[model samples]
Target: MTKIQPSAPLRSPHGSLLRRKAKDNPTLASILGSYEKFSTAALSLVVSDKNSVFALVEAFNAYRNEAVYLFESGKNVPQENLRSTMLEELFSWLFKDLFAILQFDQPTNYWAGKATSSYLTLTFAPKNFQSLFEDPNPKISKKDQDFAIGATVAIKVMASKSDDSAPALTVILPVVAIECKTYLAKNHLDMCSATAQSLKRANPYCMYLIATEFLKMDSEVTPEVTDISEIFILCKAENAERKKRQSEGKPPHPMHADVVWELFSMVMGHLRAVWWDPASSLDRGKVIGRPF
Candidate 1:
């Protein structure tokens, strides 16, 4: 994939919860540990880049069998809640590793569409991308453009019908779209013209831009709109000492907290937060909706 280097120094906000770095570290053991909590009946299919996918498959299978055995002996009977638990654990672990090397500090928000199960789809839209004005050109649908922005990483075990039924594209964990634009363009005429040439989708006429990070709509995007109460900014955390004090007291200033909270708040409303610690072989625990 050709890397589209940022034109400017995409400012990295502070205090954003980020993915942990463990690409080279021992993630196999972590997978194994998570696996040891399911039954043999449980099916798992991992489709990923060839480089690391095989080892991951093997490690998981071994862990699954061990987990089944452990449950059979009545030691740690696979939690009946294996699916949700495992999903949260794996996601947290992976994101943690990714966090360590990520450029931004925004706490990655996880959300699920109306789809059943823990499966989700991530959508990313850069605020400045010219694609904002482009129409969804039915010609370039989601499937054709799956990798156009970023790839969807989903677990394939949730779709199992029977013991023999192969696990197809089961649950879509998240469809993370990168460099997405939410607001209207500064130059409507220029944006409209550019949209004609761009192969991206435009915001639905009814949709409104939810500002985050440093993306503030100027008069160009919304001329008459002056103040928006619901919309909030996603910023970094500074003055930790003052925040600590404020928390202890009532009415903490919003600016003191990390921008991660904004994303977290948005996600918490729609999806559950699953905590996973990639650094340890332990389950960070799953909270079905909301953190703190």
Candidate 2:
């Protein structure tokens, strides 16, 4: 018999809520159901090059449109009560699909055999106590990523240098962190930047990414200077087009297959490539750019 646990910091709090929204939306339900089944099937598929990757992404975009779509009426676009949550769940499903074809069964010290998952609640900041008057037992703070690939590591941070009684802090960290949004604004970018900075400070190896369907930020606002590794805008459609279609009772725009392909390739490259191996570099005689 297996024990059931009420989820908290273990995962993002969007799965159940998104499922509830799907209950009233049959198209979404079908798409999600089919996507979930890919867990066992996708590993059998072959993707040898960029062309194959793009082909797979094209099919995926078709499925994605149904799950994260907005309905058109005229000027008023009707959205699900859990619109943002549904969009969040799309990323959850996406990474799951991408992970399906990867080799996760190969055992490694990283990620503890839980090769891939989405909407994971990870520790951005571990148990921190700086002030002398702070609580005797300080609680840790966490942030949920739409998609993450990493390990839950046990770390010890002595509460006080002079005291022997205090124990270490255990942190649930993500090596690869991704945030998915239906739209991104200036404030959203700022918050994402802050998170990227905080998590990177804690886990320097962590790769932070942002994926959004629509771009709402100002033209001058770019993520290049921020801690974010990359930000992918998956659609060319604008808000006005969405509104016009919604008024006519049409579905939202589909994601660009090329953009999705880039995202998939980026993650795949990161995972498969060796980030650091100084000992092996001496023998192989190959040097790559640092943080390139």
Candidate 3:
């Protein structure tokens, strides 16, 4: 099958804050909201210092120590599995939404630079590349292909910024190259290297999104290396209620930094953004320990 490409970029008046303007800006807006909660609470949250290793460990622990409730398909999942699935869904939303922004901005710029006509040249994947999530074996029977690729995920491209009579360059735009991956194994540097190769093979100007934590466990585990420039680490943040009660005799929750890092080492360094919902703050009354 042919590789997929991004359709024409969507044109939005705003910048990254475009998400804030939307009903849901899961990437920048939501993650920053979570950071704000951490800053306002007890633990003095800080970004990376000189030591990337220490910073990675500290940040990973900070987020992992606390647990939160999960809501899925408008319904809450079992507390035991909430964090696990919520993590996946949050990461998926982050990549999908951000790609929409790039698709808009890049093409807008291309059209403006060329001063050309209004039509856009769009190239997209047959199944939105959902096959990566399907069967592990690419070499399957024709009947199994659907099980591997699932439904055709369409990246529809329509006129975004130009009128029909506009000059060829007036509205025409360059296609975007977008890639998303879920890493269950491999270290940061290793993953970066592999992804870099894939991107370079296609186009280095591509937008890359990897839904993996600083420390990834499981069968694909590899050495921990740090070269996370293009990669976006979509992970969680510090739990609000837990920290406020940390000093009071109430011990930290079971999934604290120590526990999470025990399996996947050094998760903070690669962290680019977090998914946050202040709705959890409404549970303040149910909190056990005294606020710091």
Candidate 4:
């Protein structure tokens, strides 16, 4: 009988010191193990949500696949262009599904639009609870009202419309706001934070998100931007670029799949919180259950 050879122990790509530390520390190991399991479960949930979650994943995959194909075909394409195009497409795709799912009544409609807020025109009035513009003691600034430009993607829901004589006043309050970037810079982050803060002041329930292809800022930077609910690094550098960076002793950006899953989880949580109408429960029971 031939003697069977024993397989060598599995090796990690990390340095010996780091590997040793990981091996020695049971708490660290447990945390890592739990994160892995949690990520896996979260990803599964994201992929399984048939409404908008799966559609979002598919859109990202499509863009990545196209980028890979174009690069392989010897086409000279700027990665920034591809990233920008993908972000635009994602905005349309996501909002379309979100609008359909969230829409119920005629006036309460959802759309991708601007969310301009002016401290001069709008004041926080205690007496006039209905309208934001109804302030007893209005303090109008002499200088122009500093306006924070709305994000590329914003979900606006119509609040109320006055009588026939009065022009249909639409309250452009975005429940979901997203800022997309190829590479998120500090200045860009600051701008987004400012915009989000303004929107939140107008409507406290607004959810602000920042999505970038590359993470130029450090992890600690996100916490400092308190207005943003979350930051998603949608896709790292291309495969070739990532390998080159690794070779140069640099860490690669996060994978697209991981970021998509994180985004999906956040969106699903938000939907669960606001999607259902308690009054319509009985009506829903009477009607056949159908996906929007």
The lDDT per prediction is 0.28, 0.57, 0.29, 0.45
lDDT for position 59 in model 2: 53
lDDT of 3 by residue, 159-200 (tens): 344344422212322122112232233444464556434433
Q: Per-residue lDDT of 1-292 in model 2, one digit per residue for the tens? A: 2322211122323446545656887754665564444322223334445665555455555644555543211243223434555445444434443333555443332331122332223333333555433324444556666667675655443435456555654545677777877778889999999988887766666778888877786689878889999988878665566557657867667777678768767876776666567777876676542232
For each candidate in turn, give its C-alpha RMSD to the true structure in angstroms. 22.6, 7.5, 20.0, 18.4
Better of 2 and 3 by lDDT: 2
1 versus 2: better TM-score goes to? 2
- By TM-score, how accurate is candidate 3? 0.25
Q: What is the lDDT of residue 246 in candidate 1?
A: 45
lDDT of 2: 0.57
What's the lDDT of the predicted structure labeled candidate 3?
0.29
TM-score of each: 0.22, 0.64, 0.25, 0.48
Question: Which portions of model 4 miss their true places by more than 4 Å?
Answer: 1-59, 65-83, 99-108, 113-171, 219-222, 236-255, 274-292
Which candidate comes out best when scored by TM-score?
A: 2
Residue pairs with colliding backbones in model 2 are: 72-246, 73-246, 73-247, 74-247, 156-168, 157-168, 157-169
Best of the candidates, lDDT: 2
When summed lDDT is taken over every stretch of 10 residues in candidate 3, the lowest stretch is: 141-150
After the best TM-score superposition of candidate 4, give how far the Cα of residue 224 lies from its true spot, in angstroms: 4.0
Off by over 4 Å in 1: 1-140, 143-212, 220-232, 236-258, 273-292
